[model samples]
Target: TRHDFGSIPQGQVATAEITVRNTGQGALKIEAVSTSCGCTSARVEPTTIPPGGEGRLLIRYDSGLHPDSGPVRRYIYIASNDPDEPEVEVIITADVQEPTS
Candidate 1:
């Protein structure tokens, strides 16, 4: 659960979508979706997913709110009701750089 957005310039906003699939026998109920920091935010489509069904996790990271330049790291938390695993973690990274105009 890791994504690297190479070279995001200042003032730019980066976004990505992650797919969550339920391979188990029962339905996967997504309780909540959140980000580690204010600079990042996330949402999940269709909180309830039937077996073998998939859902999309929309993530947004605003470089302007990131506070600094260079390499940056953020996290996306997925709270769900799974027998073995209750919480899922997604990691996001970006090379925050100055815009070359």
Candidate 2:
């Protein structure tokens, strides 16, 4: 899953949702969701997905903690039970800007 939040205010929090689909014939069990830093976090709902079904991954970014004024990129690691691909990487990006007053 990939998401671009465009531009966001410096002190605000940004959120994005990713969908995990089970395209394979077997069940998809999401073991964990992790992020690179504390400023970013992710959670998976309905972690066990049946074949042809989907699950939701909620990602939150604390832009206030990231005081940079340029493009920002974050990565999410998803651990699953898929034989072919046990782990997946999700990218989230945004531009942090000072609030216009």
lDDT of each: 0.90, 0.89
What local lDDT does model 1 show for residue 66? 54
Model 1: lDDT of residue 83: 81
Put down candidate 1 lDDT per residue, 1-101, tens digits, no spaces.
99898898988999998888999999999998888999999988899999999999988989998557999989999999998889999999999997778
Under the 3 Å rule for N, CA and C atoms, how many clashes does model 1 have? 0
Q: Which portions of model 2 miss their true places by more than 4 Å?
A: none
> Which residue pairs does candidate 1 place in steric collision?
none
| TM-scores of all candidate predictions against the true structure | 0.94, 0.93
Residue-by-residue lDDT tens digits, candidate 2, 1-101: 68898998898899888787889998899988899888899988898999999888899998999667778989999999999989999999999998789
* Residue 70, candidate 2: alpha-carbon lDDT: 75
TM-score computed on alpha carbons, candidate 2: 0.93
Which candidate number maximizes lDDT? 1
